[model samples]
Target: MPSITRRRTANVGRPTSAETDILAATQRLLVNGANFTELGVQQVCTEAGVARSTFYSHFRDKIDLLVRLATELMTSSFDVTSAWKPSEGVERLADAFLQVVKVYREHAAVRRALTEVATYDATVRDFWSQELNQFTDWTIAVLRAEQDAGRTPADLDPVSATRLVVMGGERALVDHVTAGDPHADGAFARELALTWWYGVYRRPAHHGERSPS
Candidate 1:
């Protein structure tokens, strides 16, 4: 896993109802065809039905609000990952990945906006990179545990294997979601599961299953 250095902010407290309202309003605006770069603070205040000063009190800027929303989206998806147990079987793991895909679809608008903003905003890019790296770290831990149990290939490097799977899967999934083909998710999930299972975590062959030459 990579080390991440995060910037600290002075506004440190739980979000108020008004703050939630503002974030939700911003998402709605994005869903309705407003680009993140073009949207104004006053417009968001009007949509959220809050005074401009109230918005500032809760967030440092529009980018701050965008990062918060993106963080919420990523955390919600990660909540599913935290519960996953490899012993539960590959079918369950595949289902978990599918659930993450469902989340990405559910919050497509905000996600699309975040993707667009991340291209130009260094802060947003860092925040997203750190979040995904955390997921990759969790995956590496799982792979290492499987290796200890002899279910995974002992020769495999968990760090590289996990980065290939997690980082590669992230890009593939984002592309699939942006393509908007509803039928692609199931096929993609099946392939992804097989890649992790057979490609990295398959158990060694039993001598009993070998045929005589």
Candidate 2:
């Protein structure tokens, strides 16, 4: 939820009810296909039934508001990753990513808006990068831990592999969500889960544990 590029306000406090109302209104506008770059502060203020001064008092600008929305969306998805650990087995990891895909599906609109706004806004771009890198760093740490325990290949560079997997997984999810193929989510989730599990997390010498024919 932290802004990587925006300076912190000196008078920060818990968001007031009007602030929450403005955020909700902004979200509703975005969901209704309001162009993020085109939407004006007055428009959002009007939608929220607040004064233009009220909007400025709560947020520096539209991008700041979008960043907050993006932060909320990103944090909600953390539960998926929080449930994963190196010691819990790959099934748990797979389930975790599946849950992530579900989260993506539910918040596809807001996510798509952030992606679009990030294209032109440096602040939003940094916020997006920071959010993604946090996940990538966490995954890299877990992979390194597994490698140190001899449960994964030590020869693989954890940083590079984690970036590839994380970026690729996100690309796939974005494509599926944008495509509007609801039925494809399950398959996409399964394939992504399997790719990470067998492609990275699976140890090379597990054949001995397989049941004999």
Residue 125 CA error for candidate 2 (Å)? 1.1
All models, RMSD in angstroms: 4.5, 3.1
Best by TM-score: 2
> Ten-residue segment with the worst summed lDDT in candidate 2?
204-213
Per-residue alpha-carbon lDDT of candidate 2 for residues 1-213, written as tens digits (9 for 90 to 100): 455746553236688888899989988888888888889999998999999988888788877788888877777766578667756655566667777787887777788888888788888888888888888888888888888888887788888888888888788888887785787666677667667767887643363322211
Please, what is the TM-score per model? 0.86, 0.87
What is candidate 1's lDDT per residue for 36-90, written digit by digit as tens?
8999999999999999999888877888888778877788778987688877666
TM-score attained by model 1: 0.86
What is residue 202's positional error in candidate 2, in angstroms? 2.9
Which candidate has the top score in lDDT? 1
- Reference-based lDDT, residue 126, model 1: 86
Error of 1 at 88 (Å): 1.0
Q: After TM-score superposition, what is the CA distance of residue 43 in candidate 1 from its true location, in Å?
A: 1.3
